[model samples]
Target: MHAKLGLFFLFLSLAAIAPLHAAEPAPPTANATDAASGAPTDAATEAATEAQSSANAGAQIPDTLEQRLLACAACHGKQGEGIAKSEYYPRLAGKPAGYLYNQLRNFQEQRREVPIMTYMVAYMSDDYLREIAAHYARLQPPYPAPAGGYPEQELARGEALVRKGDADKNIPACSACHGKSLTGMEPTIPGLIGLNREYIVAQLGAWKTGHRHGAQPDCMSQIASRLSPRDVAAVSAYLTTQRATADSMPALARSARLPIDCGVVPGASSADPELGIAVPEASGESFGKDGKDSKEPGS
Candidate 1:
């Protein structure tokens, strides 16, 4: 009976051990190379493999114009709308593509002073800039102009400056570089319509302070230097109040008639006959002058 009882206990113990052993999965077999090298695949290696596969599956150059626009939207905002007001990124939609392309090239060439833009554009080629410009130019302008309303006094001040020259200081009207309609000229200048007040103020300030410089002799600097802080604020206010419109097809035809030699009105210094200041030739062409002709060079 004692021998039988001892055998029974041993059997019980074996049964318990057998279940425990069977519950565990077998160790995976190693490849010959891995075994020879005494190394195993790691989590990082697996992750990299997955990542490469994902990249390959999704990778393709943007083929359509809309797809290509995604590159710009990454920074500028969806639909070519500007980033938030706090960020101070400029609106690109509705701007002349020519101006946009030139600005991009300027950033790439270090002609502009924005470190972020310079770095962003450093590797981009001219073709890429043109592509981006074309994309933004085709987009519609944003509604409710970025700088919507202003105090009555401010509007009046702005209107005065835009319409009439400050003759005492020889400050030509705002309508000079910006056309009577405030739309921009093709190839270089930008339209002022629908721009944010803050953007206008900042740009003028940059020009006045020399923080921003453009292609040699910086045309904006010449114009900006002549503006008082008050003048800057007023013009900006007025521009923001104007109606924003689509790029006029007729403007392109008018651009051909503009004088090739006309440059920004220079600071109060000796005037050069060769670089004619962009003042209006006649009172009839002035911004507030009595005629209904809204068409002009750089609106």
Candidate 2:
């Protein structure tokens, strides 16, 4: 029994000394790789994967107004420059803010009847709409090349209509309200340049068919109603043939009273009978100036 006890003590001393003399092999970790072999550890691999995923997600959904408006780029363009191949979607860039704002409200209020526009803005607040309008209005992109290829006679007729009114038909010149440059008049009217011919034709037709509406007087509707199909074509063709330049910006303000009363246009009043100019009577209102020679006002 003495020898056995001595042996046990010896064994215990040996065990203790064994650990002091040499290290034991470590247990493998849950996430481990051979560092000497330069292989990536499980934790490192997972971290890299997570980082890549975050990068991809960030790319897809960046926080910016321009990025948020990507859906609009599908039709209108990235900067509201408009889609060149499409005649249906008109350019929104560089248009008057008030005009753009009005159109947005019109879509929201159902005064305008474009399903896509109405749907896009259905849930947007007035302030949101105004922001969108301002964004597009501030952008001034390069205009597309003027479209051509109309017969000379057709262009001539269009020019006559634009430059001088048809006295016999009591039709006022387009420039009378659109400005002499045909760019537009400030505060409301939109520039005619860079517009697609087909788009112009369609809008005029919409006005004529009562598919579109404006404010009380609805002068555009009245004017469109008086235009024949042929006249519409000529005007669109002529407009497309014209180009816009730096000087083609909308006029700051009207120098004189509008030849016709346009309810949407602030301060537009009836023509003076003293000048023998006839204008359409305002809706629920008559001409203030009295004259002996009376004529019909067509658009």
Candidate 3:
């Protein structure tokens, strides 16, 4: 009876140990193989694993600055070059950062009125505006060819105004602030060349009508207000015909004083928001030719 009982206990112990041994098979000596031919297997699984690893590696990186500013490109061009449909959206590349920053701020502040721009920049901070300005300022993309098909007399009249302002009317030359090259001055002022004729006219119109504004004592407002419709048309026509310089660099200093007290003097347009030289906020106005939102990527 004792021997039979001991045998039964031995059987139970072996059964428990059997499951433990089965649960942990021997470690793989090599990759799994086909039993029939002893050929290596798992080719599909190995390939899948490598593909997954590559995918994970690519996901670890971040997007570029160009990728981040898709909205700007929608109005501006892919390279911040100018584009136009019925409405002309100016090229943003190669402008002074301060100029760009100030324009964006004006739009945000309701000081420079534009409804779409206002909405676009409503949530942005000053630093963010600066970053955007800097990004475009650094990009010196090539300018598009001048689309000139206007009368010679009109273009000539435009050239005269840009080169020599109507002194009798107290309007300084466009080159007075825009530099002899009309490429723009450093710190803030913008170049007049490389813009569309309609955009140029519209912006001047804005300044004249007080629809667009700048820092207090805005020179452009005074200047534009002084310009007749003919003067605006002539100036716009001549400016668009000129090409940008190869350098495309904003000047570090002005060659001459601003000629009048329009608030673009030295130290006037500081980084401080108090200057109010920021953006032209959207004014709930339509920019499309048919009185709707302008088309994307060059409106």
| Candidate RMSDs in order | 25.1, 27.5, 26.2
What would the per-residue lDDT of candidate 3 be over residues 54-164, giving only the tens digit for each residue?
446865312444434544554466668855543345788998776677677677777655555665667666556667787988888887776688789988888888877
- Clash count per candidate: 6, 0, 21
Candidate 2 lDDT over 156-235, as tens digits, reads: 98888777867766777787777677776555677888887766776776677666677667888778777767777778
CA-RMSD of model 3: 26.2
The window of 10 residues in a row where model 2 has the poorest summed lDDT is 26-35
How would you encode candidate 1's per-residue C-alpha lDDT over 48-92 as one tens digit per residue? 343346447876423455443433443355666664432334578
Report model 2's TM-score to 2 decimal places.
0.69
Q: lDDT (CA) for every model shown?
A: 0.50, 0.57, 0.57
**In terms of lDDT, which candidate is strongest?**
2
Which stretches in model 3 have alpha-carbon errors above 4 Å?
Answer: 1-64, 267-299
As for lDDT, the candidate ahead, 1 or 3, is 3
lDDT score of model 3?
0.57
Can you rank all candidates by TM-score, best first? 2, 3, 1
